[model samples]
Target: MTTPAAPARRVPEAVHRRRWVILGVLMLSLLIVVLDNSILNVAIKTISTPAPTGLGATQSELEWAINSYTLVFAGLLFTAGLLGDRLGRKKVLIGGLAVFGIGSALAAFSGSPAELIGFRAVMGLGAAFVMPATLAVLMNVFERDEQPKAIGIWTGGVGLAIAIGPITGGVLLDHFWWGSVFLVNVPIVLFAVALMLWLVPDSRDPKPGRIDPLGVVLSVTGLVLLVYGIIKGGRLADFTDATVLSTVGAGLAVLAVFVVVEKRSDHPSIDVTYFRSKVFSAAIAAVALVFFALMGVTFFAVFYIQSVRGYSPLDTGLLLLPLAATQMIFAPRARLLVDRFGHRATTTGGLVMLAATLAAFALLDADTPIWFLEVVFFLMGTGMAHVMTPVSVVIMQALPREKAGSASALSNTFRQVGGALGIAVLGSVLSAAYRTDIEDELGLLPPGARHAAGESIEATLAAADRLGARGEALVGEAGDAFLHAMHVTALWGAGVAVAGAIVTALFLPGRTPASEGGDRNQELAPAAER
Candidate 1:
């Protein structure tokens, strides 16, 4: 007689207990991803020296090298989350690290601009896989009470990457070739892959569902076009006159279709119902805006300090230390503040400080002191600390346990998307404004002199001939013009933050944790009674 086979054994308790050990492994690996981004910022000077391409490669291409990885990352992450849920997060997570390491190796060996750009896109695909699985696994390993602290510890990697990228890049460039930056990821990924196999308990969702592949296609395409349109992409990437308008319109239509499809699907990947939570919605909006403004500063600050203020890469890194150094305290500690003060009060207060900082920055000049800039930005980072954890806790607490993976995926999606678009939007805005200001300032001189002054920013900056007399006067006017444009961007950023504050105040429930916990416990009572 055939006997029924024993049920498959689950992971042993010892194996399960070893799970948190993977966090340290993953942090070092993920830091490579984050560090690759800002690391290049400081090394811009060094990289340009050895390029085979003509000097001052088009602005769009420069933007691409930095943004391509993030765009792919933001674009593919939702799909990646679904993949993890359906197949297995552990499998995807390790695979992602492998892919990312390969891309980094390619980037390090890149011989031309095209090769570098291609490698960056490959890295993005790898990142697409890495991010979602990391969080989902962390949530899996820790209990609800313990999860936030785990996430906080995990987020500390971001702080470490941000503070250290420039410093590390500066030091590396001082010693080795620019490629050394990309090569650094190799060892970290190797170590993490080994640790992951040993310490991470591989698990998948016990209950699985269909993932809408068509919906994912539509969503990713739509985001690409939306990002392209906002950035005003050059025709070189196939953004021809016809393609630009048509691609943009098609993108919007596809996104609308995605929403409709998701609403109709029996097993939709994105939880359309989550929009009902005002707290979740408001907190997400805040995350997007804050990252947008923060990236704006980071994207251009290195260029401005080096190009205008004549700072070295090391000096630029040193200047940013304040933002990163003070922020580590804010990342985890801010949760306690959020618990004490309402999300509405802390969020509002934080945004106000961000607004004030940006507005104050509108007054900077060619002769403006670095110490002043440093002081203002230090306050900016300090205040932002108050906003981050509170918004995060609100979102996490509201999510049903079953849907937490999807929910956090969506929140992080907005953060990365906002960051990518912010670079494009803010950069384009500054370029247009700079051109206008230069033209008007040059109008004060003779027609011949006007053309010279109205030339591209490089031409004007390199024209040391303008340092005194008429040129000096024009420089002064140009500085004021730049400041004025920055003021408008700052105001836009502030307005978004203020809108978030209002939304939070309106939608958030006022119950204390004790009451909320009691309510949750009550909900569980009915099932137990059954």
Candidate 2:
């Protein structure tokens, strides 16, 4: 041999012992990001109440508040991942935490809806950096054999956030101002910052490459425009609207341009060819579809429990706890199932379970029993746990550790886009059905009240409350209308989940012991070595 290749260095014993502690810090970061979104969702009603204390935002403005965060977060994710890879993961993580805390502080004191929306976008920027860094750090810290267990634990923390966020927001709203939801992130961010500094190590790409500024511009513009179009279309229920069509068309065009550009670049921002791997493509699709169905169901479920069933926010949160509980319980166990039965079986089985749950939910009416709701909620959680956890593990295995930041950001981007589309499409379906049902019933109300009643369930209930006996009658009619809408939405979600199940079955590669690291290692080596 011309020269002997050096043996790979062993990880220090100290690092092995501290890796679990490092994971705790990473999860803390993940939890804050997850909780920020969930808490904002639960706090929307309080924040949008009539002025003096609340901001008095319109329906469109409220949607903007949520969508602004999601759009900005999604758009910046790829750039954020690249930054973390080039500049040191721990450094980016800390900077993100600081920026996030500042955004939260500003958001808490915002005097108007516009101010809050802008600040939320700032938080999104910070979240973009944090999300990728956490997963990248995990990858660098853990060896391949240990990744499944670590990922299981990481996903469990995400499940716990889902369980806690609504309840926490509900409790805060019951006793405090709506701004308390934003303020809560401050302390958590501080704690995570401190812990990460002490426990986590800095890591970066071995061979840093030039940043592709044009790629960043193209990706961000494409995502923001696409999401904006979807949100506007869903709210209006008019896909043919000139503004929506133009915006979405432009977004698609830019994304196509981005694909061509990435193909030609020597060091592309994202390697589009990664989709060539069956496992990689399947995991991304599974995540997107699963989230699409899940988000649609949850969006309506909150309204069903609170408006139709007449539960308090706290009570509603408690009612939804079963969903989170089952997810948490089964997430870790999903890895065990993967070890025993293989990823294909577990993933498809989970999808089938979710489809069945959605189908059963489609049959429920306003008078459906609470016990039935609880059972299905738990079952939905179980199905999601099985599907999401294994899919995440497979995604991690499909990509090389060196590309972890980009891969993680790519996975998260699909999830956000899927969730946004789900809310838009399913919401449009629900809105169309509800408006049709309510239109016939609204003729009995005062002309002024009729328009308000037709707008939304909340507005309908408020209008009814003002009308006394007429209001009571209207409430019953509105509840029935909402139930009908819920049924239609559930059916659509069921169909999506079934389609996802079939796709999962067809696209997800069969597992064999030799296939896990072998192919990915061979494919990733050239770039990784550079």
Off by over 4 Å in 2: 1-10, 52-54, 444-453, 513-530
| Winning model by lDDT | 2
**Residue 160: error of model 1 in Å?**
1.5
The positional error of residue 397 in candidate 1, measured at the CA in angstroms, is 3.7
Cα lDDT of model 2 by residue, 281-313, tens digit? 788888988888887787778778878887766
Estimate every model's Cα lDDT from 0 to 1: 0.68, 0.79
Q: Which residue pairs show backbone clashes in model 1?
A: none
Task: Write one digit per residue (lDDT tens) for candidate 1, span 1-530.
Answer: 99999554343556447656767766766687788886877866555443442223234455666677777787677777777776788788888889999999998878766777788889988887888777777766666666666666666667778789888887877677778888888888888888778777665666655677887777778877766665553222233457666767877888898899988888775666666555667777777777877776666566566656778777888888777666666777765665576567777777777767766666665678899989976887776776676666656556544444565667677778778777766655665555566675565456765544442344454343445565666555555555555655555555655665566667554435754754642343232223
Score residue 523 of candidate 1 by CA lDDT: 42
Tell me the TM-score of each prediction against the true structure. 0.84, 0.91
What does each candidate score in C-alpha RMSD? 6.5, 3.8
